[model samples]
Target: MSISRLHIERVRNIQTAALHQLQPFNVFYGQNGSGKTSLLEAIHILATGRSFRTHIPKNYIQTQQADALIFAQAHQEKMGIQKFATGEQLIKVNGDSIATQGQLARLLPLQLIDPQSTDLIDNGAKPRRQLLDWLMFHVEPDFYHAWQYYARALKQRNTLLKTKRQPTLADLEPWNQMLAEYGELLHSQRLSVLQQWQTFFLHDLQMLLPEIAVQIDYRAGFHPELGLANELQHAHSKDVERRYTEYGPHRADLRFKTALGDADVVLSRGQKKLLVMALKLSQIAMLHASNKETVVLLDDLTAELDSTAQRRLIERLSQLGSQVFLTTLDHVAVQQHLNDLSISYQLFNVDKGQIHAVEPTIYN
Candidate 1:
């Protein structure tokens, strides 16, 4: 599935723009600060119904504007042209006009590859855990409801612990029951997803970089048996001091490690980019295997990758056969790879937040 056309008004620097209907490989060329990333972010928002960049929805609105609008038309093989529209600088899917953000995500499934993804490897565990939960939510619809219920209960429980003058270990019994019940189900679902992802990632890694091995491990917040109350009891003092949740799956992490020695840990910036690309390719494979079509948004396709790794990544992306929207600054770079694959793609030259199709004088 791929977005055929997109209409944007008052989104960041893009006051008004229209991206002509796209294809298997759609490339956008422009200089830095020319809104390439913003364009890609718009597509990502439309697909996932959430900003992959900043949490501040207001930031998406133009400086003086109160609201922003993004309209898209996607062509799914089984389901004809699906039109989606959003109001007040929000993300929407299939024009259903849902009030909830998550409801929009279920409609336009997507996998994104951006420079920020390196955070998953070098930074905190939140990003990696989010990846797992995102995939799980798509697979299990009811999981979202369970997640919401648990989040509400957890918030109330934490608030009580913080404000109650006489905080006791036993006071959390009721909340613990609710938290444990939902947490267990969520953990079980995540474990199943991780198992499936392990196979997918291993296979894709072999194809993309056979010399290296990759593994993903899930570490829960605490032992399942301790229950929420017992865990809270153990951390009562710390909780009182911090006045917030010091422990829970929310604090858990997904660890990525290699069997290779520690000396192999030092990866150049470019190598880190390649590793991130490999993971995204693996995610696309998993999404495909699940019988789902995902719209892929790639920001600055040639940023830190060496020519060889770039070619390899492009080839793998092509094999995935999903509709891709990519941005780059090098004309020759895009031409060489697109020619190598002998695939016809649409080219749009972006300038001052506007996009226009550029025709090649000759075909290779």
Candidate 2:
């Protein structure tokens, strides 16, 4: 699925904006703080109903504004029938509908690769886990609901552990069972997706960065004698001290390794960015393989990437049979790699939160 049009108001620096009739590839060029990233964030909000950049909706509202609004139209072809999807999503502050956005995630799977993507390797485990969870949420229909239940159960279990001190095994047994059941199920689902990706997309990723041998490891309370239940029991004293559950799937993490070394240590700035790009590419390939069309959103596409890696990325993205939205500051950054490419793209020039489409003749 692809977005045919997008309308925005009171979002960030963009007071009112409407972009329609998108091409397969779009390039948004602007100086820093000119609302370029906000455009991408609006698209992401429409797709996931949440801002990938900020947690606070108020931040999305322009300073001193009450709310923000986003509107989008999506197109899809299914069973040889073309269909249009439309919706109105709203975010209200103080009981008023000031801003709104919505998205068709399943029909419109989007892989957003941004400058922050480098953090997937250089930072904590949450981003890496998110990579797995996002894929699982889209591929396995049941995973989302199960994950929701597991999170609620886990929170309740932690609360129980916190309030009640010196609780016996019998008191905690029920929550333990629930945690173990859901935790194991979540782990298995993630492993299944990773295996499929490794089998099909890993090779294509290797082609992007030929030197590194990438590996994904899933560890979810997977130790003998100290399983999920045992770990909980073992950490009982610490849980009481900290007033929270210390371990479980919530504590689980993924480890990425390469033939040269661990991703955390040996990968350079450019290498880490390449690793993340490769992972996103793998996701795009997997989605295409399942016969799902997607829209790719990328911000700061030139950062931390050398010419060779950028070329490889463009090639992989082109082969996925999907529309792509890319934002960058320097036209020269894309000109070297995308020059003479026959793919269709619309160019937009952004200035001070205002955007206008630039004709192809400008490049000529």
Candidate 3:
């Protein structure tokens, strides 16, 4: 669903703002600190009930502001959000209260590409797991509950391990059983998702980054020989000593290998960016197949891409029939580049925390 109208209040530097009649291809161009990126962040917050820029939702509210509110009308369905400075956020979809982020995700699925996206390949395993889990959450119906159950059980087991009075086998048995059952379920589901991705995503990845020979492999978080239950049993003493569950889906990670060796040891910064972009695009493709029109948020869309690469990525996105929100600080260069590519797009000008729709001719 594309947002036709958006209302933002007390977010970042924008005390109040509204953008109406939003289009499929929306561009926000302005000088630094004009709040261009904040607009995209607001849109992201509305979609995910979380900000891509910061983990702390409270920090998104303007300084001295007690709360922030965002309301969006898309595809004739209304979604409203009230995020308090106290770390509480409320969501109402179509006038009905929503408590689950999954519910909001089902309504507004989006893919984001930004400077930090390279972390998908360059950083630790958490980001890769997050990327894959987002895909699984959308495609697999039972994934969310299974994941939720597994997390709760893991927390309980960790707490038990940390108790001053050591937990007996009987005390740990129930959580271990729950963790094993759900962990295997997660393992099965993750493996299934990876198989499906391999069916077409490999080819799709090639299309995005032809020169990079990066490979993706999944580690199921436990030794295949020992299995989850046995691994948990064997690690019990160490887990108690460490005060946390160590060998389960929580430790799952996606390993990146390349023709030269491990990707981190071989691929350049630019190659890693392109590889991550391909992986994200493939994920969006899988979702778009059924969702029809996934909203794409591209921050600094041309940041690491050359002119040719920029043209390719934008055109590829357009072919998916997706709505794209893009930001660029170098308006003249970006405008000229898009003009050279010969595509029509809407431009919004941001200045001093205010944004207004600008006529296309303003570029001329």
Q: Each model's TM-score, in the order given?
A: 0.89, 0.87, 0.95
lDDT of 1 at 136: 77
Whole-model lDDT, candidate 1? 0.72
Worst 10 residues of 1 by lDDT: 77-86
How many clashes in each structure? Answer: 1, 7, 0
Per-residue lDDT tens digits for candidate 3, residues 1-364, read 7778889998999888988888777888888889988988988888888898788877889998889999989987999888888889899999999888678888888889887887888789898899889889889999999999999999999999888466666788899999999999999999998888765567666887777666688998898677888888888788877888899998899988877898877887887777777787778777777764678888887677787667777777776767888998756666665566566667899898898888765344
* lDDT against true structure, model 3: 0.83
Per-residue CA lDDT of candidate 1, range 84-158, in tens? 222343333443445666755666678888877677677777887787777777776667988897788789778
Model 2 CA lDDT for position 360: 53
Q: Runs in model 1 with CA error above 4 Å?
A: 76-96, 225-229, 260-265, 360-364
Cα lDDT computed for each candidate against the true fold = 0.72, 0.73, 0.83
Off by over 4 Å in 3: 336-344, 362-364
Q: Quantify how close model 1 is to the true structure by its C-alpha RMSD in Å.
A: 3.6
Ranking by lDDT: 3, 2, 1
Q: How far is candidate 3 from the true structure (C-alpha RMSD, Å)?
A: 1.8
